[model samples]
Target: MSTPVDTPAPATTGAAPAALDVLHRVFGYDAFRGQQAAIIDQVVQGGDALVLMPTGGGKSLCYQVPALVRSGIGVVVSPLIALMQDQVDALAANGVRAEFLNSTQGPDERRRVEQAVLAGQVDMLYLAPERLKLESTRALLDRATVSLFAIDEAHCVAQWGHDFRPDYLELSVLHERWPTIPRIALTATATPQTHREISARLGLDDAAHFVADFDRPNIQYRIEPKAAALQQLLKFIRTEHAGDAGIVYCLSRNSVERTAAALADQGIAALPYHAGLDAGIRARNQSRFLREDGIVMVATIAFGMGIDKPDVRFVAHLDLPKSVEGYYQETGRAGRDGLPSTAWLAYGLNDVVQQRRMIDQSDGDAAHRRQLSAHLDAMLALCETIECRRVRLLAYFGQEFAPGGRESTACGNCDTCIAPPEAWDGTVPAQKLLSTIVRLEREHRQRYGAGHLVDILVGKRSPRVAELGHDALSTFGIGADLGEQEWRAVVRQLLAQGFVAVAGDGYGTLVLSPTSADVLGGRTSVRMRREPIRASRPARATRRAAAQPDMPTEAVPLFEALRVWRSTQAKERSVPAYVVFSDATLRGIAATRPDSIEQLAEVSGVGAAKLETYGELVLEVVAAAA
Candidate 1:
């Protein structure tokens, strides 16, 4: 169990009877994982909690079991309105009374749910944080007998968090307005700073706080130096994750559309999803991605929050992520069912330049820009580091790790761990690059972006370089021993190391930082990674052989049959197939090959209501396969 670190634990509510009963009867889990029992017990006894568990660590159960065991409706504050319906339906499938109120509902629909709440028919009530600010909504809740309050994605209240929402700042009013209604704030991703901000902002200073292990041991983290990014992404998918559901994230709407189209052209079931698309199109795409298998949703980050798909095999980034928090949460979306998954990113020079330029041009004080710069710096270091990826990742969240149990690798499951990169002395390459920038500034009284600087270093007398007379400089051709790519790597690493600064117009011109003088004076040595060159097409066959598919040969037929049954049931009910039963659950059924409903109930994810609903149909499918 992950213990609560440096935070107060709520005194245990002695002798709780129905908590475990609700767990096994309602959700069909025999026992709680990690800190769920303690967190649930606290909430069930009218004590507050602040939970920071990773995605798919069963964060929902922390609030849910308590909601069912205690009296009155559990008021849940969910940030995403679009996902509320699916969430409510998933609970209903588990035989729990759940309802949601948001802008999408009609007046009659809202009234029906309100009447249900008034009559004490609702067990959990999902509301948007913005709804709490409404006077009429407050009065309605005031009249109803209220249980504990659940603030989902509670880290949004922290201004420095990756997904900041101003509306979450108002959530402290839940404790004030209903002072006795114990409020439990929950988020899957939170740094120490974000955690502190959440406690301060949500008035959870006295609440029991819990932090689960942030490391996802099942995910193999790999960062490639970007070269023909779309091609690299396609090859990765084809070789390792073909016919498997995944997400391909790009930074812009245009990139999302282009990547989706390109993948579709190659016979993949790809769909584009971003805020720039029409609302109806986005909804339809989201629905298909959820209902159908073997989909690759090419999207911006806008498409992933609140998504509960448990079988996502990989998450590929065509562009660099903004921060570690954003990257971790986005990657956490993959392999939610505890299967092996890959978190792959194609990172390069332009990503660094673009992020730095954005920070420079952003609207904020110097401190704010510094904050953004710090985040980008950390992200860049992660991409460039030669250490164990999981170790560095865990340390960022204040957890210590000792690397053990190798899996096709040296340390942990990551690119560097498998094929370790050499840390060569970058002093010469750094001096050559910094000399060009220094001479350009001293003699020409101007700095230049990487392209022009690289041309000068490589002795390439292009028209612009000739016109600018940079070819005559002493530093010109000083780096002729290395290729342009190698020179760019030196500059990229220097910028990442904070020895060189990105400054001037929005073009990402390079300048000397205060620390650059150390390299120029030979007072400090620069270290850089020598990444292995990527191979072309023929190597993919080898990768395909090494990569394991999602299912074994014997189970594939039964899994397909079960999927067909789930599809029919979902179509009849007009809900996503996963809402009926997640692919993880189906895979569990196929693997266990249960002959009776009692045996089916023994499988991990076959909850009480699910077993009661589909048990016979699943047994018939298994029998036919046999």
Candidate 2:
């Protein structure tokens, strides 16, 4: 027997609301930020666009608003099934007729949504790319009139990207099939090369590219040397971000499990998420992290993409990421609501060796291997840079990082600017290393990795040195004054400065570059930042103060009451608490302490439907707290 699916009445049926009207009455915002209004206007006017907005920048509104304004259903192509469900659930909470089709749906449930879509009862239809790849699904889309096509996480179309999906390659058919419908592709992170690749692969070359400022000023970047990684991570969480929702990224499944268990043993609410976990456990853990306050999730990179939880207070990395793009996207998950957040990372020299080894050992042709190596080199340079981490990170994506002049203004948020590291003249050492590499290639006709070169420089008498007769080289004992660690730092700096290059194959051998001539001939002076000694005490995550909510002390009880009410509502509905009311909105309700529904309607996130649904209850909580 088939159960009848009740279709909720539309909020307003006759005329499409203006963009501002939709923003306020639907999504509960006073105005559009950044280029959101312009992007919405463009898409509503039936133009194609490629939107590169930072996470928590309201990328959803770009399509959601237009879907309400334009006739027919807006088709959003999402990649993950869980993400699709979450999105549709959130939309439904906001009184939007949103539905999703994915493998998680049984045949009857899927047919119900399909019937609704064809009947024009759904405003937005979310589908995984793999779903659209099915001929039956494509035929279904053809039968229904779609208002527009939105490709979220469009970077997945790039074959070289970290999160590539082969199904995304077939998305070009959207343009071919619905040639008249507007299309907008969006992603939180993309470098210049990736930007171009996404534009080309998605058949969005002709679309207007709206690249917002890649700078996430709310997130403070801090990187430290890995020493007692677990204890350091614990001290950081306990001291700085206690009782806040945060994520800890690990390099392996084992590390994730161990870290989670250790945090749990320490009385922290921690859970592990990795591909190795059973699907039910992974789903449950993810659900708890999204719904519960102050739960820490220890996970690999598989955990964060498309997660809509906006209150994540911090994202910490216990291991080095594969590339800058991966790091940027992962860290961007935090501070989505524009509150102060932390991006803390712990890395060591061994991370470099392991990352290089992985790249070299991977199955790929020379060109492919070279591409991967270039990506890693950029990331390594970021890790080792003494300049502002934000500046270097944004520069990787071709954005000039000049927030202010050095003498007058600057982004005082990053660790480097807050605690400046001293730079020392490395001209003499640079000359010696360059000379060593040249001699190794010219005299000995040999190229060696950093470890071998450092060994020879520091006068180590290894069997390989004796076999190669490398000790006979003049530059061998010249570098003996500097310890092996110091020499390693110098080589890494040289690689970063382009004075030296990593040779072919997995050995990571150093080779002289054309720029090395300038350093060797004393035509250019090299200045390298001295690596800070590993801290014996726990390092402070950031000098910045912890995030403080904007509310009066007297209203604190009211805020708690509202949270309790929201939790109850979310639990009753079997959805994440934020879907009932975000923390920011609850705070606003508390601070304002509205006495009536009309007054509560003025809150930033309170829309007509939400005001109608939860308005009276919110006021009741506020009044009761009195």
What lDDT does each candidate get?
0.85, 0.83
**What tens-digit string does per-residue lDDT give for candidate 2 at 91-200?**
88788999999998999999999999999999999999889989999899889989999999999998777788888999999999889999999998888788889888
Residue clash pairs of candidate 1:
none
Q: What would the per-residue lDDT of candidate 1 be over residues 1-626, giving only the tens digit for each residue? A: 12343443443433366988888888877778867888888889899989988988998888888888888889999988988988998899999999999988899999999999999999999999888889889999999988889999887898988989999988878988999998889988887888888888998877778877776877889998887998988888988888989999999999999999999999989999999999999988988888778899999999898899888989999888999989998999998878778899998888888888899899989999889988888889899988887777766777666535333223447888777788999998898888888889999999899999999989999999999999999988888999988877888888889888889587789899999999989999999998964444234335433443645557767988989988899988878788777777787788779999889998766788988898898898899989
List CA RMSD, all candidates. Answer: 3.1, 7.1
Off by over 4 Å in 2: 1-17, 402-409, 427-488, 491-526, 532-549
Query: Could you estimate the TM-score for every candidate?
Result: 0.94, 0.86
Q: Model 2 clash pairs?
A: 448-509, 449-509
Instruction: Name the lDDT of candidate 1.
Output: 0.85
Question: Of the candidates shown, which would achieve the greatest lDDT relative to the real structure?
Answer: 1
Q: Against the true structure, candidate 2 has what lDDT? A: 0.83
**What shift in Å separates residue 613 of candidate 1 from its native position after superposition?**
1.7
